[model samples]
Target: MKDQGLSYRLTAGLEGYLDPADALVTALAHGGGADNERCLKRVTAHLKADVKEVSAFLGLVRIRELPRREDIELRNTAFLHELGPSLTGAEITGLYTELVRRTREAMQGRLGPRWAEQLAVHDLPTKLLRKRIGPSTVADLQQRLLRPDHVLLTDVSQRLSGVETALVRKLRRGAATDDVIQEAQMVRAHADIHRMKQQSLGTWPADPAIEADLDERLLLVARRTIRSHATDPRPANAIFDGLQTTLETSAATHDRWPLYARDSVLLMGRACAISDECRFDWGTAHESPA
Candidate 1:
């Protein structure tokens, strides 16, 4: 079931990237208005092709089917092949390295120091390893291994969300032709870790510690968004709506921690109030707060 869930999340993550990619491409193709639209169409087609290649690579990783290296020269050839023209060689290497680093970090966080050994024994390609480890041991190992994958999958999904958010922000800003073209070229570069950190906090894990953490993160994100977009009600409201939905969903799952839920709801209310005041000020004065 966990494997199935991972597969589903992987697909969802790819879809998350694709949906925004499509919107971005469409926006870019039309961003130049009718005069330059013909030229922009070629750019959009190239970006679409790039997205397809990246999607193929991500799909392979999703299924755990990435080809093993044959030699030092051929190392990461598959990744390079799939990401060509979209990313420089160094960028592709860095991206792969970041993925590996995140996977390791996830394992360490979930499995402690000896995660490599723990994962390796369970993932051994032979039935002999499992037989020797015994049924109970195998089951225990499998359960423990599931958590790292869950953490990794969640991280991937959150990064996709960040990309989508960035694209939406660009769209809301009435992205110029150059901005749209640059954005399309740098689609994978939009996964801001700082932004993702706040968004990632809303994931499930309904303990007191997690609840408190979520509350803090949500407030920080809301305050920052409100401050940055004080005069721009559209972007501020979009952010507020996303955060509100996240907080509400989180609050709903706090049957075991009603106080936490109450506090989160109150925090959200405070944010909304601040947003309302800012919007009112903007509307009345047509000026930003000093």
Candidate 2:
């Protein structure tokens, strides 16, 4: 059930920023090569992102690019709010210290304390470990999605395997030539369109023709988005930047260690192992569950 819940969230998050069919196509289109790098390159998020922008933004690349010129103060305040609602100073320090110490020890033979300290300056928790992930995260994600240079190389690695699987399915079923074309069209149509990013258009899709046009637009939108990020990736980059971002500041003030997470979450219905002796010891000590 927890797996299903995570799966459900994943599906929702994908739809929120990705074009499903186009992503599949991109995955199919870019998954394989003589070299076999990543699903796509540019959109991939290599650092501390909850959503991997590199291979993931593949389907939504076709949207119109609107320049964002927001007021600096308002934008800064919002960013802080979004990222500030999790973790505490001390806990952040603890995690950072542990991560750095472990990393240094692991690499001591190769790089020594000097290089390790340099690396430690950037060590922080990955996106998955954070207590808060929201619009600020999304905004950062959008940066990678839009830029050819901002990709996370490692994020696309996992998708290569999936692409192989998807390609087989498509080829086996004899899927049509128009299918990829249709998907591409969808990607281009809305690859960059956003309701929130608008300058306020009233009743924008004003005609029946436009309504139908929107439906037809889906495939192109998929193409534009996917193609931009169409590079296979490495897997370790997201955590790297995520950890580094934390060094700039502590975890959000609201950050609390969750009871469950991908790496450390305790699952539902795992039996607590309390032996009779332990129970008797606890009773003798007059200890209660804290």
Top candidate by lDDT: 1
What RMSD value applies to candidate 1?
A: 22.2
Residue-by-residue lDDT tens digits, candidate 2, 1-290: 55676421121112223333444533443432112245344233343443444334333333322323332222332222223324344443444455445445544444434654545555533421243345563464344233453334342334444422222222122222444323323322332232222213353344546324432232233233334322313111221122223322422211122111111101100000111001100011112345
Q: Give model 2 RMSD, 1 decimal.
A: 26.9
Write the residue-wise lDDT of candidate 1 on 1-290 in tens digits: 54676533232122112123444433333332222345335544756756444443333332122222332223332223232324455555665565455445544434446646766675653333322334454353334334432433343334443433322323333222444324332432232222223344664354658545544554566555445554553443345445556666655443233433344445454333333222111111123357
TM-score of candidate 1 versus the correct structure, residues matched by position: 0.17
Position 180, candidate 2: lDDT: 36
Candidate 1 segments whose C-alpha is farther than 4 A from its true place: 1-215, 221-233, 252-257, 260-267, 270-290
Worst 10 residues of 2 by lDDT: 268-277
